[model samples]
Target: MKDTQPADRGAAPTTPAPAVVTGKDAGRVAFAAFVGTALEWYDYFLFGTAAAIVFNTLYFTTFDPATATLAAFATFGVGFAARPIGAVVFGWLGDRIGRRPALLVTVVLIGVSTGLIGLLPGYASIGIAAPLLLVLLRLLQGTAVGGEWGGAVTLAVEHAPPGLRGRYAALPQVGSPVGTLLSSGAFALVLLLPKDDFESWGWRVPFLLAFPMMLVALYIRRRVEESPLFDELLKQDERAKIPALEVFRSAWRPLLVAMASALLGVGGFYLLTTFVISYGADTLGLSRGLMVNATLVAAVVEVGVILVVGRISERLGPGRVTLWGGLASAACAFPVFWLIDTRSPVAIVFSIAVGIAVLSVAYAVSGALLTELFPARLRYSGVALAYNLAGALTGFLPAAATALLKVSGNASWPVALLLVGLSLLTALGGFLGERMRVKDPVATG
Candidate 1:
């Protein structure tokens, strides 16, 4: 348990000293961050997967196939649209109150929203109401997860000793690929169901499973202590009254550049994971299971790469390695579509797996990199706003890609060009952020 006593500031109602945690306790806190992030993102990945493979036929049945697909992808992006709002609200809470409690709230909110999605009636049962309800729930999920990453990442990085901040922060980031793998693997198994049954109710299994997983995550999170850095701020009574505003006023440069870097990573990854499924299925006439399975294999590869990058960041510098990832993403953009065009499952899997691994290089240290971009006083708000701002931009990438592909008569050129463009921006942002990075004595900023 964390020390919550008020500090002795030489008067009545004095603020207490910061609670000190040992090295062993740091690992526990980081682990909690990892578990909660993984569970929340598991639901995130489930929605993305379902939107790509199943939601169109069920919720937008009234439209033609292409229109329905566009509608479904739009709905998938709606969650991202709500993320920045969540970042503002929760970023205030994290900066004002404490990182631990704020994170706990996000976990419960995401779990309830995701589980409810499993119970929603389809368009056949309720007409337009079905899609409306899905949009509402996806927005709620987006809000919850939008708040989740900053707090979790800050928790891990702040709790660790200064030297290993990258590795410890990366632990929570491992959740993204792990969640993607579980969601992908779960859907792949459910896809084995007969066609009629799959279209009917098979896809709900993963969403429903989120309830039990949330319980486990909540239990683990409860055991972790508050961030030592935040606690120190509390002791000094230096907590910002409006953390979001403070970040906007004092830290906008890092926030803007960081958002750009995150855009390439988030948008490019979604293009590969969510949009590729549709392109492979509709354009190439491939099996859904094959695309999902290939994603699963790539997800497995991504997990390893993220962990390795985290370790490597301890020596080579997080920002520099992440810049390499941006160049790699640009180089791989053409090949990603070219391999899928081949229509061979082997080539498709190889492309996605290798592409994701390169992307993981940036992702591996993203949490730490973002955390290090601002003063500890405003770290949570700064990073949360930057991260979710990127989410808001990229949330529509899949739908936009779908529309672009259709307009160009199903050509992959537009999508590849867009990715390369995003990657170039990411590289520029990475270079600027590294140059402008504030050097903190604790190495957390």
Candidate 2:
């Protein structure tokens, strides 16, 4: 008998026009992707907050406090370092199999690893093995998240109509704040327990809670179809066999520009969201509840700013808006420290909220701009590699900057200003990227 059955590779790709995704279709897809990304980030930010607050004690307490904290942050950076690997591996699968399937696997991996952390025995319970397991699990979580952002953004952008792609894709990007809000809120709530109660048991509750949420994300994702763009690529027989290498060979310049651009607000994101929480508690003598509350305020403000800046990009263009926003972020870095130093609760809240708002301009435009940088064959691989590399560079920044502050005799203002200077460089890269030619028929080279 002749071989009649189609290959068992995966589901048939669907091809929908990128510029014709109706408002209703875009809304449904974007919402699903948004929730999915939000859930992914929730696991990540939750761990970041925990690492800053408790991991050193729970996993590394045997060493001197400074060494323990440094070790904890080193482990934290390890996850970021693992991201590019995930991007390459998962990006290939996404380009080969489809976006939905690749993302489904990533979300589950992250949820499982995060939930398992809650059940891990601490150093006292398991001796030296405890921290080792924590580091291993963290690497898993990092790898999973490294895959999440690229796939989520691809889904939203590929499904969006051309004119509104910038705004449509931004919905999922905004989910970062929604995730941050939930993660910070959970941590803050848990902090209300007595110190002994918290250290003994309460810390696990927030992580355990991520399981049910993950199930919900999985269900929502399953109902969504693959991107129409990928489908069209299949119909045209345009799939690249080796996407990662192709991206490096063909789209290297855009990839570099995208990486530098990504470094802008993400560094600010860690500083305001992760570092500041620890700083408030340890350096400023703020209560745990108060510090977390300030972070929550920032998250809420972050979501709002995402909406405003995303819409603004639709009008002014992603490049111009992001450039201006980056400059504004650089300008405010010094005053942000001043606000925090006031030792007033209101000042702390204002500082974080303002910082998030300024960062939104760059954050809102990034997904769409990066997605538009390459042909669809290498889109997943190209965008994922660039995005993850930038994240890896900046992932440990908060911890490093904090250490610098201490080493420099608490020269808080200058250290903070140095972060702003980095933001200026990010802005410059993004501006250059904006001048590149817009690729036509985005699904094929």
Highest lDDT against the true fold, candidate: 1
For model 1, the run of ten residues with the poorest summed lDDT: 1-10
Compared to the true structure, candidate 1 yields what TM-score?
0.94
Q: Tens-digit lDDT track for model 1 on 39-147?
A: 9889998999999989999999999989999999999999999999889999989988999999999999999999999999999999999999999999999999889
Query: Quick one: how many clashes does candidate 1 have?
Result: 3
lDDT against the true structure, each candidate: 0.86, 0.81
Candidate 1 residue runs with Cα over 4 Å from true position: 1-22, 441-445
Clashes per prediction?
3, 4
Give a tens-digit lDDT track for model 2, residues 109-218. Answer: 99999999999999999998999999898899989988889899998888876677777878988889988889988988888889999999999999998899999999
Overall local distance difference test of candidate 2? 0.81
Deviation in Å, model 1, residue 174 alpha carbon: 0.6
RMSD of each: 4.3, 5.2
Task: Give the clashing pairs for model 2.
Answer: 14-231, 15-232, 16-228, 19-162
Instruction: Output the TM-score of candidate 2.
Output: 0.93
